[model samples]
Target: MPHRLHLEQFGPVHALPVLHYRLEFAHLVREAVRRVKPDCIAIELPSTIEAPFLRAVERLPEISVIHYEGRQRRDGAESVYLLVEPADPLVEGARLALERRIPLRLVDVDTDSYPRHVEALPDSYAIHRIGLTPYYEEYRRAAASVAPGREDRRRERGMAWRLQELAKEHGSILFVCGMYHLERIKDDFGRPQAAPLERVRRQGVRLFNLHPDSCREILDEFPFISAVHELRRGPLPPEPDDRGETLRKRFSAFELIVGGRKDLPAEELLRHAVERGARHAGRGEEFPDRQRIIFRLFQEAARHYRQETGDPVHLWQKRAFFRFARNYALASGALLPDLFQLLMAARGCVDDNFAYALWRLATFYHWQRAEADIPTISISPEEIWGGSRRIRFRPRERRRKGLSHLGFLKRKKEKRPGEWLEGFTDPSICSYPPEDVLIEEYGRFLKKKGAMQLSEELSRTEPFTSSLLDGIDLRETLRNVADGRVYVRESQRAKGGVGSVVVIFDEDRENGNYPYRTTWLGEHEQESDMAFYATPPEDNIVGPGICRCEYGGFLLSYPPRRMMDVWRDPDYVFARSKPEVLLLAALDYSPEKHVVHVAARPPRSIFRQIAARMGKKIVHIPLGSLSSVKLKSIRVLHILHGHDKRQVAKDYIW
Candidate 1:
């Protein structure tokens, strides 16, 4: 609703005072200006700074600041800077007036006399739900309850007097000021009492460029909100719609951050997430509310983090990470976390690289770099955006030659004869092999996941209660409690231990990245015999001869000596693929009836027939079904020099 000025002495001017924090205010002011089309526009800023302030507005999306020295009081010097952000409503409204060539008046007292006060106010966004009149009424009532400040009343009367003079010059006008001062300004309109505008000595006025990274610090809204405001090239509502714009922008950002790698799966995952969130929105409501949209984007980014680095971020972990982010926002006196806070929380809760994914998702705005020909000045983003930090960069000294060292200059060279060193590559000297620890841990994890599959295969029978079968079925018993009956369970004997295990990361011909392959003999006689294909540890020596290798295909069979080097065995020539040979070898070595085959897909019918011929059944466990992160960790194995090196290896294995 338009704010009508009903003063008998002052003509028909709309006094439109607006809250400055939200992007909605920019839109509100824009609409008000278009609708009223008043004969003249009156703004709250002083006439002296108006020219440069408007110039700063023209320089955006290349942000600039208006710096002017305030009245030099006897106590100290004071200076004021008006950050010309894209989302400021007063600036936006003024820009519209200038564009339309409306006669404009600067009505408020100059900056030198303006008094600043602190007040904790409710969220300005609530005005989107409630009309401006109601919001102002609530604000006015609250103000009346508290003792008014002398400085505030003086400022209101000054503005009111200025508005009256402006109304005398123009038939109708629009006055834009702070919401807190408008009610009192109206009460003092056309009154004989007038507050004298203070005049004092002023200093140099200048404009400074604002860095893109510093936009968040100086702007009223979060960096992400400013980013969105820029992307839309206009103000967005409190709860805006997500029409795949975020997905497209984030994907572009992800590609740029990752150096132009197109990730179709990640893109599809985010698209599906947005679609799912849209389904939960109310009818006729904007699909995928902004908050929900951001949540889903973060979730999809986490999933992509897993795909890229083999680190799974569980749903609970995501929840906890955002909880920390929100807390950071609250500590910073913001309603929600900005991109910087979210990235900081993600890095602490997740990993350093994982936060990179979130940052890419959050800071991307399509219109950030417009092709406008506007002149821009340069300033370091660090100088403005460095929060609570004082950073300085200086030229570093050049590196000196090694021989330039004073001690090295005085040293003399000594020669020694070349001789063979013992135990350099001997495997027997290693006390504990890292492969053994990795295999044992991985086998434990596989067994845990496989237990569920085993239970699914088992049959449950309901008969007269005998002992507890599979531990008393508490859920079943509780369901029948009202019927006056107690239910019990029977335990079944398991077939055998997880004796034979085959883990294949990728199908044959797909293991291009993992080129180096080898088989290692078990250092411990009690441990399971293993034969596998992996990246050679010798290629990546972490410590001396200790090398890290990723397993492309592996076979672990318990009861030492049951498994042989399937890679070297010539009798397995009938197998068409490398993984097939491992699978065939696992089946041939397994003394038990079933062999666990973990891969993306189940083995072909020929492998099943071959296993059946050998009186062994193959238990197919989809590798994708298990946690990729756990599997990736398990696949990483370190090769030690020898068994004698076990003590040293133990320290580095974990």
Candidate 2:
């Protein structure tokens, strides 16, 4: 429920002060109109531009701008523009008056040379937690310290004179004006006032439709939030309380008879789910929550990000983004973050692809169009806000264009269905050469890292008497500062070198995600013998003979062509999962006394005991210690039917 403020009243007139072009103020205006039910509605715009402004407001949900020429000065004449948007309180009040058939009054005095006034105010989102009464009282206290200029005083007196005239005919009146001029208008209403010298009528005033692309740069509130407000303004059905109620409401007897026992279509199910989510998010409340709207925006952007780049946004990234955004808002003295802060946080926490996705979603307004019923005009950020901050978003693909350019290309698809399946007729299959080189390089790096960890475990430190064995250990020397003695360290090498490396990307214990398994020996001396389990190739065919797959776990052993198919090996029958089987094969086929294992967790203790019985050791390396970017690059593998297909595979891979 909205908290009603004690507005200033004189006779039958009530004055409500508001800030211009704010969504929270618009909601307050809506609530006030419903509660007051006044016969006449008064706004702060002048009578000269009333006709064109009302016509622009009639095109609700579509934005417009009023253009005119100001008075001539010693230098030249200036162009003036007034934006008419759904998020502005003045626009909403005018729209309500027209919709409810109430008498509308435009009561401000117009002057061609009115100077622009700018003031710093707190973020309006605070009204959600703090009531509007307290918010208005605080604004009143702060605004009382500033004095009014000549034109401001004159306009306030003129509006007071109009309200006095309106009070005689109408039984009740609601006057909506700016916070800066409200106090002066209320004081002048009690005393007799005269009409000030101002422009009674203007010539050559025109209204134009705002271009859809320009909405992002000029609007005070973001396009997505404004659209949310518009959606809540219409009639809405009663929201279900739980899942059972929602199912009962959606699955009716008519639907069952018409669909004949089949499930709902995917698009219909998705729409219903979205509608339920919106209602559960409190869109039916008296005032919509800005934080909830921001949360939904991020979720929608993440979905688009996943569809565009084959990558999932992690939960940790989302937490970090909100933390960063909160601190950014605090630094700017705001209770909540704006669109610019959200974009910056997204780019800092994730990558450019996610930030680009967020930008596209934030600027989308469904009702906006390039072709409208009026003359459309394109404007820039400099024209409205006087300045803007720039950010560059470059995706993974390289192009010749600069930072200001944006272009999108359609992904290539098969000309006909089942055309790619025909390329799989060949009996033989081989791995792509480039992917093999990358995996082998990563394996060597893991082996080197494991050796260093083993060496550190064997080294010892002691006090130096005459000669140092290896070198002085600075860390130990610092610890013995009280004794005033130097510490020396001795290093010993491990007994054997690492010969096999096993990398586990995912331990699929349920045995459903990755089902494909294969074993292949190297064709040349440079490659290692490989065995792996991965996603099915038939699900993602990219080209005539090429298919892409992600590795679940893999084994790489040097000296190719010596190992048999490990997936069917009877010796490793005790293994529980595909990752365990790969670990056992690594211990069995390794030529040296040491093997490297990399995964999210260390292997079972039984594997260590089995290696000890065979006079070998398992060196565990945590998978998170490696670079995620490098790991992601090596996890993707492409298979080809024949060597001739390698020449055209580059065109199909991203």
Candidate 3:
């Protein structure tokens, strides 16, 4: 009973106004057709290219383009293209008519010289919330101010004439046209209309299958959302009721169908995801909610990203992504973010690997293929949209030759399986020299930071009489502005410098994730003796002797060889978790008065008491305060089986 279903009815003709090539409008067209059940369907396409256009539509989920040479002008002859996509309302109407065996009409004037009109219209997504009738009314009010050109008027009259001619035979006709021309066409229909000048037929109009890659750049709706619409058009699997018996019955059938296929189609996977999302949201699956669809898309993309990079996308990153995307869409005057904004958000919130994963998933259309019965043509964003924006995605893993031009390079791989693992024969393992230097530098930086923090904690502020102890305390002076008295701060330096730094990347309370625990003595005075627990090195062999691992928690003590193997020593047996053990070792081994502790949360109160007993102050610095990018860069450590393996490690490492 929505106003959209009851369009502008004029006797036998019911005209439906739509924003061409929009997913919401396409849904509205399908709903309108089901409700109206008209005998004939009329669309605002030129009769000249009707054959090629219809043929393209018949291809359905596989997208196609109607290409033809336009009329020559003073500038030159230009090429015209009509994309036949499931998201297009006109194409949907024609498809419905053909499927129902109803008469189809392409009634626009056949002039190849129609000037392309670009209007700053509201996003079509608004229709989903406000209803199509209100959306169209607002658009019509704004468009009334801009008068149509002579050619537009001629086309309107020509379509009106064709509708009148068709009305003689068909009892009911459904007219689907762009909102811009609907009013003029209705006006011409009320009055007696004459056939305007137009070509009777177009020659050399051909249909071509759209190359799959081109769908990312040229499709009106991105492929992911388009595929959702296409999936909804077919018969959907039955949903479960409260009794649950029906679900069990249907699931068996579903499993049977899935068991037969070697590889499940992408659409089928998307369908399952959509249904699961809808069930979780307590919403009906009658229409696809764009917001939920995008959420599922991100989840799927994140899954792929984790599979490819072995790094999971955190919940905080997902929250940041949606927040950024929402703000970007608002800045662009859109209710929802487009493909570009989504990609930007993904890249900004996470990393290039995740962005690449999202782009790959968004551009995938199951039915599109390089080889087709019809001619396959590739197009670029520049050709279809006049201009384009660029985003660089430097994925960790290299791609094949076709994508090498897009900033992807071939990565080094072992010539044979288990070849890299053969280099692990040496008994002794040592840290890569460059990684040692990086960690040593970071330890020094942490020592300095801890000393500064300790100094701040011991600083005192008092009323200034004559001599300022250190400097005027601007904050304290401002607080006593009413008294007109100045305050000076006297900073006290710690008795001894920091000697040990403990950084906990993961608490590992269950002691499960990081299984490789070791204590290594430094080779010289420059490197700190270290104790750390990390992922098992044998799991990821980057080179023959070089294995990559991530740190869980680590303790660094200065004065090189003074520290013993803390992981094995029974002195720290009272510690509960891996991080606690490291903290205990740092407090015990630090010769200086202060020890630096970096982690997501402060160490337990018992650790502070233990540090106090050991005559050392624990300086707790939040892990989040530092740059995550820098932390990630330093987290990865490469272990070489022998010191000599460092010579060839660089070639295998990224």
Counting clashing residue pairs in each candidate, in order, gives 16, 0, 0
Model 3 regions more than 4 Å off: 1-6, 235-284, 394-422, 451-496, 507-512, 562-576, 601-615, 642-644
Query: Candidate 3 local accuracy as lDDT?
Result: 0.81
lDDT of 2 by residue, 442-553 (tens): 9899889989988998999999999899999999999989999999999999889998999988888888868999998988899899999987775556677787777888
Candidate 3 residue 605 C-alpha distance from true site, Å: 5.0
Question: For model 1, how does the per-residue alpha-carbon lDDT over 1-654 read when each residue is reduced to its tens digit?
Answer: 233211112456687767665665665676677677788888777666767777876766556677766667897766566677766777776777777888877766654555565767665555555656676777778877776577667667777887877777787787777777777777788476565565433347677765444443455564445444443443332343333233211122223233333434433444343344334322332212335445755765676565555345755567778899879878877555655677777776665556766654454332333233442333334433434432222211223476443332232211221111122457443324445676777865665556556655774635345565566667667877787666666545447645578898855476565666555555456577677777644443434335555677888776775555677788798877778888888887777777888987898999889877887778889875676435655766766676565565543343
What is the alpha-carbon lDDT of model 1 when measured against the actual structure? 0.60
For every candidate in turn, the CA RMSD to the true structure comes to 12.0, 6.9, 7.3
* TM-score for each predicted model, relative to the true structure: 0.55, 0.81, 0.81
Higher-lDDT candidate among 1 and 3?
Answer: 3
Runs of candidate 2 with Cα error greater than 4 angstroms are 4-10, 71-76, 235-280, 398-417, 446-513, 531-533, 552-559, 562-632
lDDT of the candidates, in the order given: 0.60, 0.80, 0.81
Q: Could you give candidate 3's per-residue lDDT for residues 1-654 as a string of tens digits?
A: 244453788869988898888888887888888778899999999888888888888898899988888888788877778899998999999999889899999998888767889888898878777787878888889999998998999899999999999999999899999999998888888889887877897788889999988987799898888877776676554552223111101112122223311334445553454444334322445577788778878987887665445455766788899999999999989989999999999999988878988887787776898899999999888777788888898755534466564332343555655556567789998888888888898989888988888889999999999889999999999999999999999999988889899998888777787989999999997888999999887655666778778898899998889888888889888878888888888888888888999998998899889888888889999886665556766787888899889888877666
TM-score of 1: 0.55
